[model samples]
Every structure is written in structure tokens, then in C-alpha cells.
Target: MGKIIRWISWLSIDVVLGAVAGMLFFSKLFHVALPWQPYVLLGMAVWCIYNLDHLLDAQKVGEKLSGRRQFHHQARVPVLIVIGILGLLGLVGGFWWFGWGLELQWTFLLGGLIGGIRFLVLKFGKGWMKEFSIALFYVIGISWLPFLRSNSLDWSAWHGLFFLLYLLLANLNLLILSFLDQEEDQLAGFFSVSQELNTVSLILWIKYLMYGLLILLILVLVIIPSFYKLFVAILFLMTLCHWYVFNMDGVDSEKKRIGMEWAFFLPVLLIFLK
Candidate 1:
């Protein structure tokens, strides 16, 4: 069971599920009726991005590849073949599933552009950039469809607030992972936000991020409509889970990573609520 969970997390199946849950949460919140295509495409895109990132990292580090990266390294060829097939399918299916309205076209274009940039950053860039870029793109990928479908086109302040809160939540998760994997990353000679700060400083930053996320979640809960309050509540719980996982003594980083990834799936509960 543990190996299964680790493999699921390693392949980023958990992340894809979490992304779909988030997309559905927003779609329901905004009263938009989304087809199945968006969900499928989003899942494929997320899995590809994450696996590619892992594969890239795995290729770079020789003996220092972490457990997840090492798995990716061992299965590199199969993973690459699958990613290529999915990418091609997603491209063709996207065009078929979402007709070429200018809005849809622009949406795909922007997403592809950001994804390209993120891939480049992973290959050449180091430090906080990779973490920040991944967080930004993840939020955008999950929320953009629902936002586009929303009745309001004015880009209301509340919409901005909601996405901001989510982005922060995503960033916090990445930071915690980076902190947990700091030792392995250093062994692999990989740079991340953790590498830029001392242990004390990184812990301090994580604490600050959690506090800020807590307050922001509460503020959004208060100001957003009752319809959207549940989403904020879900985020609040996710934040608490992160705090718990990060502070868990005697637990390894891989377990912490799994815990945090599971937290993101809380949004799936919204489906039952509806």
C-alpha cells in the first residue's frame, strides 16, 4: 500500500486529481457548466508537466537522485513515450473539444506559452524561480477555465482575491516540499528556495507563509459570497494540514510530501457537497 501510494504520488496522479478537483470546485462555485474535455485535458497536461520536471531532474543528478527522481530516472524512456503520446492527444483533442473561439484559442496559447517557459526554467534556471513558476502556472491552469466561463468579465476584485489565496497555498506547498527535500536536493546539487536560505530562515519563511495564508483565507471567506465560502474553507483546512505535515517529527520528507499532496485533494469533497 505504501509503495502504491508513493508510486501514485511519484507519477503525479495525485496532483492531476487535485487539479481536477480544484477546477471543478471553481466551475461549480461560478455556476458554470464545464464539459468533461477540460477536466481530461487539464489532467493530462499536469501529469506531463510534473513527470517531465521529475525526468529532467533525474537525468541531471547521478547518484543523488531522490527516491521519486530515481524512479523517474529508471523509467525515463517509458515516461517520455507516454508523455509524448499524451501531449499529442491533448493537442488534437483540445482543438476538437474546445472549438476555436478566440477566447479558447487565446487560453490555449497562453497556457502553452507559460508551460514552455516553465519547462525552460526547470532545465536552465534554479532557486526560487522554479517553485514560484510552477505554483503560478498550476493555479492558472486550474482556475482559468472557470474564470473564463464566469459571468463577470470585468475581472472583479473578489476573483483576484480567490486566485491569490490559491496561488499562495500552492506556493506554500512547494516551499514545504523544497524544505523537506533540502538535504537530498543539496546532495544532488540542485538549487531551490531552501538552498537560498539557512535552515532557520527557511523555517521562518514557511511559518510566515502559513500565517499569511491563514489570514487571507479568513478574509476571503468573509468577503466572498456564501457560494464561494466552502472553497475558502477547504483551503483553510489544506493550510492546516500543511502546517501539521511540516511539523511532524520522525517523519521523512517523502511521507510529508505525500501528506501535503493528499491535502490538495480536499477540494474533491466539494463534489459531494454539490
Candidate 2:
């Protein structure tokens, strides 16, 4: 039981769940009839490996706590290699399942490589790598390519608004997670926005920024008639809940982080239901 729990924690199961929800959102939005089973399995496998970047960082934290250097520094190399290979396989497999052309597959592969390089730099480079990693995961990996593939380069007011809103919400979510990691990140020498700015001021700014974005989304929905309003609402509520959880100051940080991540599925759910 202990081992199982540890494995689950190590795998960042909540993040995997959120990613699945994102995939489902895409499928529903596109009305794709592809078998979800393969996508789910492949997505989970790919995300699990992608998460090793964080797990490796956490391992370093553990090493700090134990005060004994146990795992070799070279251990992360194998994990990165495995992640790269599996990411390629998952990209090709997903595109194949969707009957998308080789072009889409190549795009995904290239994006994955770029994202992977960012991860590697974060792992080995200097200040704020972790925060940079979070941004890359959303802005580059999740929002940009997916939107480009789905909506194409057709420039329209509604599509542009949607893209902006998506990015705002995603960045807000990333900011909240960074806030939650304030302590651990400070200890780890990770210079996130939370660390760079005054903590209290940063939190306040983020809270209001997120709220403003949500309101803008709702207004856009009213004008443009998009179901994404519901999705944004759900995400906003979850962010509020996350703030509550953070302020409670009783629950463990890890638990709170995991819970917030799990709650991230609400946006995905909304996107799919639309």
C-alpha cells in the first residue's frame, strides 16, 4: 500500500487526469470519432514520463531531507531518454488514430522536442527553471499547438478572443500552482514570480488578475455565444477553492497541490460537455 501510494505520488496522477480531460476536450470540440482507449493509455504513458522532470526535482528534495546522496546524478538521463522516445510514439499514435496527416504528426513531434529541450534546460540551468518549465508546459505545449491545429491560422475576432482567453486562464492556473509551491520553490532556489515579487502582493495581484480574466471570458461568451464561458466559470471556481485550500494552512502542501491539480479537470469537463 505504501509503495503504491508512493508510485502514485511520483507519477503525479492528478496531472495525468487533467491531461486526459484536455484530450477529451479536444476530441469533443472536433467531433472526432477516434477510439479514446488508445489515446487515454498513450496520453497517460506520455504524461507520466513528462512528469519525470518534476519527479527528478522532487528526488533532489528528498536527497536534501535525507542528508545522504543516495541516487546517482546520472539517474535522470535514462528517464529523459525514455520520455523522449515515448513522447514520439504517443504523438504518432495519437495522430494516426485521429487520421490526421503526417504534417500534424510532425508538428507534434517537433513541439515535443522543443518542450523536451526546455525541460532539460530547466533541469540543468540556473534560476527560475522550474517556473519556466510550467510556462512552457502550458503556453507552448498545451495552448499554442493544440489551438493552431484545431482552429488553423484563420484570423477572426472570436477565434482570437478564444485564444487569448485560453492563454489567460492557463497562465492563471500556472500562477496559482506557483503560489502553492512558494515555500518549496524558495527552498529549492527556484525564482518564480511568487519569489521575485513580494509574496503577499504577488498573491493579491494574481487573484485579481485571474478574477478579471474570468469576468472577461464571461463577457465574451455573452457577446459571442460560446460555451467556453461555462468552462471558464468552472476553472474560476476551482481557483477560488485552491486559494481557500492554500489559506487554510492546515493541510499539507503536497496534498493541496494534488487536489488543485485534480480539480483542473473541471475545465476539461466543461470543454467536452460543450
lDDT of 1: 0.86
Q: For residues 1-274, what per-residue lDDT tens digits would candidate 2 score against the true structure?
A: 6455445545556667666665555444433433555446546564655566555665666556311112323345665676777767775676666557664666568667877877676566544454555544553443333444553544446544544554565566677667766766678766466656667876886778667875775576577555445545654566566556656667765566566666656656554556
| Candidate 1 lDDT trough over 10 residues, lowest sum | 153-162
The per-residue C-alpha lDDT of model 2 at residue 185 equals 67
Cα lDDT tens digits for candidate 1, 218-254: 8878878776788789889999999899889999888
Q: Residue 8 deviation, candidate 1, in Å?
A: 0.3
Q: Which stretches of candidate 2 lie over 4 Å from their true place?
A: 1-9, 30-34, 45-49, 59-62, 65-101, 116-133, 143-156, 226-229, 247-249, 268-274
Q: What TM-scores do the predictions have?
A: 0.92, 0.69
- For lDDT, the strongest prediction is 1
Candidate 2 lDDT (Cα, whole model)?
Answer: 0.57
TM-score of 1: 0.92
RMSD of 2: 5.1
